[model samples]
Target: MTSPLSGIRVLEIGDRIATAYCGKLLRDAGADVVMVEPPAGHRLRRYRPAGVPPSAGDSPFFSFLSGGKRSISSPTVPPELVDSADIVILGSTPAEAADLGLDVDEIACRTSVITVSNFGWSGPWIDVPATEFTLQAWCGSTGSRGEPERPPIAVGGDLGEFIAGSYAAFFALAAHRGGGPFDMSVLEAMTTSMQVFSWLRKELMLLEVLGRSTEVPSVERAKDGYVGISMATGQQWQDFCAMVECPDLADVPELRFQVGRWEQRDLIRARTADFFATHTVAEIVELAALFRIPMTAIGNGETLSSMDHFIERESFLSHPSGFRAPRAPWRMSATPPLPPALPPALGDTDSPWTPRESRAERTGLPLDGVRIVDLTAFWAGPTATHLLGMLGADVVKIESVQRPDGMRFAGGFREDVERWWEYSWVFHGVNSGKRSITLDLGSEEGRALFGRMVAEADVVVENFTPRVMENFGLSYDELRGFNEQIIEVRMPGFGLDGPWRDRVGFAMTMEQLAGLAWLTGYPDGLPTAPRGACDPLAGVHAAFLTLAALEHRRRTGQGQLVELPMIDVVLNASALQVIERDVAGVLLTRRGNRGHEFAVQNVYACAGDDQWIAVSVRDNDDWHALKAVLRQPVWAHDLIYAEDTADLIDGHLADWCKDQPRDETVSAFLAAGIPAAPVVQPPDVIDNAALQARGFFQTLDHPLCGPLPYPRPPVTGHFVNSAAPLLGQDNAQILGSSLGLTAQDLARLEDDKVIGSWPLGL
Candidate 1:
């Protein structure tokens, strides 16, 4: 079957995960992607897995990201080929691109160009070196992870780079139908991907103002292992207590509401902790599912690999290292992805496509003329609709006046403001570019109005539990009856048919359940929540699948239901651990901030309070370069140190770095061609020069917030209406324009409480 991107040509420059994975996505969609590496080949190719034959030339990390793409060693490719390409993905800094003689403007004029970087081309820290750890730190994710007493720990693997790559692929595909010179900052991508924390932080500020406590237990240990539990609603809390056979606690008035539970969290935690200690993870999971409680085992690599669902779904591809690699996060009936293939050898000139006639001129954004009815709240589902909105879809977000999106009230900023909803940067950030209309789906009139809107919408999206749509009479079958061509995308924590389908889950709990928490943190320490990365990961998958469904409908003239189980998407993101467990029959364990693949990798203290730098030495050349940068100290030249004795080398490296400024240490190591970066915090990320130069942050003058810096979506060359609609801001416009409802009708609906511009109590 011909893939969606069959005729497209993608040129990937740089060996970084972001660019490589972006190319992989394009390749999966049947694009002819050619990766260009330096003369020595890409640095990632040298990342050899233990016991792998050298002739294989396959590094699990590199192969997983760069698979199904051709390669060329030369820095400079022919300009004719560049001109003929449909997209160019550059993973280098602005300086590196200029040095390579790759004119960004000239290339963008001919085809789309997406430049991915650490901070961005024009940010103040654009020249400052960075790594996954530092990016997470600067983005606020690391700071929120683990126990507050312990120093922040980075999440396992290059999740920041992985997320940036997903954004790059989405933007590239969007630009292909339009045109571009887009720029993406890994830091910004990571920040936005996990923006749910921003909301939580804001909630804390409001709680403080209201004299309320803000404390909750994210992870707790069971008899054999750990499990994550979330009781967002009072009913879930009651169910959890009942499942544990704690009828007395379930009846306690303080444990009835989420706020009351927070106020008396210490007492509640002590009781639950003891109860959890008496049960095993499997037993807890079973009871939670049976009782419709929001609790799940903190699975490890072994548990994930042994799962029947993933194995049956064929979520992984075989790896040469006896492990496995993740397949694309989506599948389709028609226009399915191309089969996976190993990354091509450097300088291999194999081309998958022959010259074709120039395509006809493309006009508006890729999703132009499409309309979506968005019934999602928080990050994941909203993020999907936001991306679609940026791609020129007319998205109408429906919220009830009685139950507004929590983000509207959870502004992370402390402002002397009157109307709180208008000042919510968290809500505005993700909801921008979409219209808003209030509809109480519980009401008969509201349901009738929603059906009318769905009839005109091409897509309907919701992230509620399995029973929500059915309860509201807005399920896929009902929507299909209203409009046969309407595509319905449902994002539930578990799938619709599973025993756990009714269980409640947030991003934090889902991460633990999917084994991400167990894979992070110190070796002997407890599991840590990796913030909200799972939400954006799921969001990206939902958006990609939605587009695929749209394409299928375009060809077949039929629409279908798209189910995106949040747990499945999160597990797929951590495919490495599953693969390792599958191959080695052992669960992967956390190693703190240490690198598993590199010989010498650790975070070391540097000059200044709380300042640090991360360094990774992969081989002899890297060791030599690092030693030279450190002034060739006697200890650095030791054979034991050179032989990958990471624990022993870490102490010596820490001593060496203690007196050196973080920037200096990072610069020296980078200049010497060693992988090193400073641990930048959130304050350092703001007011960054590169981000400023690239206009990564835009100032939107909100009515209540005045003006605030909003991070632009990591894509360019498309219509981005930056204004986020106020509550029911588009009620009149939408009612009159689409549904032909008169102002009197809207007033009547408002009087009947079927529509409103603000929350009922507020």
Candidate 2:
């Protein structure tokens, strides 16, 4: 199959991983991406990934990032390449861009320009340096990590930059039609995960906002290694209880819901641990499979490299020295992404640039005329469609009157409240900017009406387990009969045909399977499960592929089926760790609040309750600046650069911060241009001065929820400027006007329970 982006061209100018990863994504999608590296080499060449052996030369991390892209040895970008590019990715701050001899505004006039950086374009910290640890700390997710008495932990690897890079690709394609300059911030992309959900939940219900106290996703000691498990919904918990032979836990009234179960986590943890300890990993897997529990064995790098599922699916690819990586997170039927080639050597040559037909001048949004029929629920799929809606696609969400989105009743059913289905803040938060309409897909009349809508729809999206689509008789082939030009996006937990395709998997299960859980937490071998970032990662991956499919349709007048398995999303995010082990004999383990890239990164206790501040000394300059801030000079300046001195600096920062208040300590560090932030709580996120200054929040007025502010995802565009619709808010307009159904026809459908505004049997 031909690559979807076969004719598009991209010029990537930056040494940062965010830039390199952006180029890689475009290249993977089949764009001709030319990477500009300095004559000596990119800065990434100076270091190798952690745990990589000495024989792994020239940065295996860089090689994985620059895969499939031709590299030119140059101090400055070639003017011809920039002029002929459809997209130019500038992964630097304004000051650095000036040093690169690139004009952002001038180049944006001809092609789309996406600037990816750690901070914002016009901010006090714009030119300041940042690390993954510091960015995660500033985003507030790190604030809630680890023990309350000890320092918080950073999710290992350059995962933050990878996320920013992925967002950059989405921004690039999203702005293709609309020629413009766009800015993507690494911190902003992370905030859309733990931080946004943390604060948004507090704003809605004032519940347990962050994962500070309770741990729903906890790791237990299996006979061989460990297993990570979570019960996201009530049903999963019941099945888990039954499978473990603790049927008593299932019958407890308080344990019926996830929120309630969280209150008694210690008791539940003890019971599950006892069960897990008695069983081997294989035995636990058998039990989980028997009862369809959402759990998985916590695999390490070596285990991940040889998983039967991965081997069967051909999920991994490698270069020389056994340096490993996963394939692209998506697959298309007609125009599958080309398998990426190994990283190019410095000064490698490719064919001369030939620009394809330029897109028409976009009047407003890039996806102004596009229409999407959304059939997704829960976190990942809703995240994808919500982002698409923000890019100006007219997204019409479909839910059955009798069987609506499961998210509509997140806290479980309530007998007292009359309209319990409309009370989920999670549904409102994730599904914003789309019109909702109810229809019973179980009925024949409703299926026929859905077929008619498919005939006029540009794309159809869903996230059911594999059999649901086939059972509904609405697979891509079936939808093609309605409209041959329709693009269908499927987000299964696993791919369509894998042996594990039908396995009951959720966000946490995929995380365990990806082995990222093995690399998180403190220096201890036990896993500190992440806050289910995989789901949102899946969402971002899905949205990117949908646009690629749309571009394919624009080029070949062909619509294809695309798959974004959640497993692939997490694996791709955690790819570096797996590759590190592949290239080395040792496994990459966790170190709390510190990384191999930094000399000093720690969270110090402050004056208030649970108050703390994150500190990262990036390099020699930062180390000196930190010393100057503290008015403490080291007698041996020459020896200060050594790794042993990092321990001293960490101790010094802790002592200095322990006596002072968090605000004052953070202020001192920031004024000195050091990367430091207060470990902000969930409630404080709503009024964060930095996000407020960036205008990151938009107010959407809802009849029931009032005019509340919602954090916009990290992208520059005209998002849908409305709140989430009521269950079937647009039923009348869509059915009566668009479908040419008479008032009597609509009344009859509503009476027959085929269509309605609210739940049928509520």
Candidate 3:
């Protein structure tokens, strides 16, 4: 089957995770992408597991990123190839990119292009090094995450950068069809990624002014487990009290009122927790449905993976590489994309053209010439843009002098011991492909200049606090006045209107208010936050939304507001969990890494201290396997009908599992047709043989961060390909000539603080 984006060509250069993933999306849509890799490949190639066999001569990163596209050696690629490319992706400092003769202005004169960078080309820290963790910290994500006392933990799995890149891809495609070239900002991308937090912060500010509660009710602990109950309306509150069989409590004059309960929140929470402890997980979930309160169980990666919906929907696609990767969040019907066979080996194919499709014709390209202008920061917003970029949009990231996005200043402002891009690993992960150009949009002249750029852009994406845009007179109204056809995405913590419009927040805080954090810890312990759950969850939603909006624009000439509130998106994404609460009024509590609905389930210790096995039995058939593994019919019999089956099962299973070898148990379960998985470490995930068998990991001989490993595209469709991009490495060709900028003019822009060079220092 032909792909939706067939007949599109994308040229990706530089090191950015978002751009790379975005390129993969385009390839999936059947785009013919010429991924121009540096002499040593890219940084993503060096991301290896603890004990996996490293990439030999070729890059292992390809197993994840290079599935359907053609690979080309960057420094050695023929110049004609550059000129023939339809869209060029760049993500380097302005000066470094110009040195390589791939600047956006230069390429724009010859063909369409997109520029992506840490800050837009004009920012003060344009040349600073960066990583995803640093950016999360600087953007207030760390400050609000975890216990609020521990140092901020980076979100797991480089998700922040991935999100930024996803959004970049989304807009780039629209821009390509709309016009010529554009620029996207990484900072803006990150900010948009935190839509909910940004909105909440704004709301809190307004609340402070109004002299209302500045914070949501704080939850320190719960009896049954941590939980969050949101009864926004008076009737809902009344219903909730009744559902818990505590109607008497509601009759108390002070308790009867929502405002009053909030004032005495501590007492109410304690009372609520005590009530919840009496009920089981099932009972609470069912009862919440009866009362129509918004409630959900606290879950983790395991829960997300094991959801029946995801399994039935085939949200995860098995690869030749081993591990099953997730599918793209959004699915399209018209031009359904197919997943590729596997990631590419470094220079896996000898030529740019496969026998099936020649480079000269550029067949199989999904998005032929889409373009995007990215102005965002953090995770959510940038993630959406990156997805778009991956699908064959020319994504350009914009930046300014104010604080550069945090990712750009990672690694203590110094190069790593190896002098590689290690410190900037996070930056490279998110901002690949596209071009880089600096434009200080905060100044009057800069804003005017941006207005001109907007005239030529298809989509403008940002995640600034609502005030930032207004302060610079670059609000939606002002932007639309410049170009009504442009798609503008305004992502705040809360929506534009609300009582708490200016509250300060981040993913951690959002998780708490939205009830996620409250439900994640132990049943009797404080709430716990995941390493980086918010970024990926919010990013996936943003990506889904942006793509849907793009399709809407394609069908209609009108371009309207795309408002994604982080809190709202999270709430919606978690609707499955909350629906029961909203309908039944049963309060939810934390289960502490445990699952429900399975008579047999647990994470049991294995031969090693850290090694463990997660196994589950849904019916009698699996129970038989459990019996076989335990080799104890009497113990199994006791569990099946004992009055205290849970205790019996725990005791026997604990002893049995503690002495068993993890691999041996896993094998026995697989052999017996029981559902089991290892409680994997990062290294375990990175090195799983199953993943390798599925051709999941990609190998690349990166110039910096040497021989990195990257995971394959999570989703595979009917038509799919995966390709990553380089840094602002495509600037010269994109901005210098393609945008009609003269060499003299380009030189002047460089001197006038409009665009700076790459790798500025340390």
Candidate 4:
């Protein structure tokens, strides 16, 4: 099948995995991408897996990323290729990009330039070097990781770069469709992908939206392995209690609410934890499925290859070298995605394409003038539309009065207030800048009215299980009937056609099933994750495919269906872990605060209460510099020159850090040229000095929630001044005024239970 980007030509001159992955996505979509590698080749080519053969030329990880792309070993980009290229991706600082002859101003107006860097284009630290850990630390989302008392740890497997690469692909296609060149900060991308904007801004502390835990017994031990469970609503909680056969908790009114359950967690855990410990993983999995609960066993890299779902879904592709690699994270109808293939060797396919005229840039935000019908409820679906809305798309969020977006009551429930749902900062943060209108699909009038809205919309996005849309008679076929060029994007937990498609899975399920959770946490402990990463991972990926579909429609006047499975995205993000089992003949587990690239990486306690700092001695230079700063004794230095001094140095470093303030210590590390950052608390994340100076958070005013700081779009410059709409706030404005419905017609419909601003019974 021909891809949406089959005819496009792309030139990739990037350094980070983010850029390579972006180009790889373009290539996977059938674009002709020519990778310009340094004479020594990309760093990934030499990135050997732990305990694996150290043959630099046969890197399985590099092949996983660069697969199916043509590679040329060249000192510089071919001039003719620049003009012929539809896009040029550069993963470097502005100065370095200029040195590589990829200066934005110097490039032709037609060739879209995409730049992804550790900091960003104009930031003070843009030119400074940064490791993956440094970027993860700066993003603020890592604040919620690890035990609350322990120093925060970076999520393993370079998740920040994985997210950045996903967002870069989204922006790349946006730029191709006259959205203009973009400079994306990997830090912002990581934060955004983790839904820090929705969580940190509202002070939910972290991503508790969708189905991961904030105030629940989320991670628990099974007889053989660990499992993650999430119950976002009261029904789910009661169901959980029933499944555990906890008579005291089952059908209990107080336990129905999260806050009440949290307050009585000791009692709940006593009953639940015992049940978990006594059951095997298989027994628990079966029980959870029988109860239709959103739970799954936590599988690590080694276990993932053995999953029944993995085999049934054909999640891996066997390479020519007899190793396996993950397939694409998403799929689409009309134009299916290409399978993973071995990457080209150096100097292979060095041939250049003929010169072509560049397309002109469009004005305003990337998605300007596009209208989206958003039917998403929780984090993943709302997040995708949230990003599109930020890009200037007119997003109309469709919810029903009987059952609005579950996120409205996600964080809390104030029984005293009549309009308590309107005050949810979590809902406001995720749904910002989108219009809301109520319509009961169960009613004929509501369905008819929705069909009209669909006719005027360019895209319809939903996170419902595959059957919900078809049950509503508003599937892709129905949407296409309303508007032949309407892009239908589905965010399913498993996928549209997988054997587990109908199973109730959430981000927690994905994190465990995809092997990411297995790679997190301390080496000796059970797997945990950077809470609900699969939400935004799938969110941004959905947006990327939606953009691709839009571009395809622009060219061929046809809109198709795109399926973004939350688990697949989690699996793909854990690709770095996936390759290890294939190459090293062993699975890599969590290493706590330890790092792979650096000589010494760990966290140390500071003087203040629960305060800490993370420092990495990249090499001997940083180690020597740290010792000089600490004024270590001559005897200590005489003990060793370069033979396993990391642990010894770390012990001494811990003593020195205990007496110093965290921020002060961080400054000292930075001054001494060491990679370091504070493990920021949730409140401190909002007040991060660097983020404040960069204007990362801009204030947006909501009627009920008042003025609040909203994080800017990951790639866009800043946020629009609009706010998340009150439930059904746009009904009168849209139905009566815009959709040509008479006032009398609206009133009659409201009286007939066809529409409402609040839940009918409430």
Each model's C-alpha lDDT? Answer: 0.72, 0.77, 0.52, 0.76
Ranking by TM-score: 2, 4, 1, 3
Local lDDT at 446 for model 3: 59
What is every candidate's alpha-carbon RMSD to the true fold? 4.4, 2.4, 18.3, 3.0
lDDT by residue (1-762, candidate 3, tens digit) is 335456667777776676777676667656677677777776656543211333443333344455666777656444566576656666666876776665567556665566676545553445544344334433334333332222222233344555556545654554445433556555445433422232222221222111112122233333454444443334556777787666876676655433466567666666666667766644664566556554444443234335443455554455455444444433333344557456555555444542223222233334546567778665556665665565566777776434344444431223224432223433444454445555667656557667877877777777776677788888877888988767777776645555334433345545654445544444555555442346545655555445544555576655556666665544432322332332233334555433323444555667875555666564677666778877766757645732236556766776887888887877677677666655442322334343344333455444444444443223211112222233333346666666666788767766765554443333
Give lDDT for model 3.
0.52
Where's the lowest-lDDT run of ten residues in candidate 3?
A: 203-212
User: Which candidate do you rate higher for TM-score, 1 or 2?
Assistant: 2
- Please give me the total number of clashing residue pairs in predicted model 1: 8
- Give per-residue CA lDDT, model 1, range 407-461, as digits (tens): 6754433445556566665577788789999999999999999999998889998
Select the stronger candidate by lDDT from 1 and 2: 2
TM-score of 2: 0.94
Q: Candidate 2 residues 1-762, lDDT tens each?
A: 788888788888888877887788888888888887889888876666433445535667777777778877878777777877888888888887888788888877778888888776755567655677767777777776665545666666666777777778888888775834677777778777644366655655645565454255367788888877766666677888888878899888778766677678778877877788889988888788778777688877778868888888878876543577888888888887776567778878644486545545666777788999999987789988998888888999999888788777664545555676665766877788998888888788888999999999999999999998889888889999999999999999988877788887877778777877777777864677666667777888788888888888888899999988999878887777777777665677676666767767877888867778877887888877877887765643454754667777687677778778888888888788888887776556666665666666778887776776776777543354889788888888998899999999999999998888777656
- Candidate topping TM-score: 2
lDDT order, best first, reads 2, 4, 1, 3
TM-scores of the candidates are 0.86, 0.94, 0.53, 0.93
Show the lowest summed lDDT stretch of 10 residues, model 4: 204-213
Distance from true position, residue 526, model 2, in Å?
Answer: 2.7
Clash list (residue pairs), candidate 2 = none
**Pairs of colliding residues, candidate 1:** 122-689, 122-690, 123-689, 123-690, 123-691, 124-689, 124-690, 202-412
Which candidate would rank higher by lDDT, 2 or 3?
Answer: 2
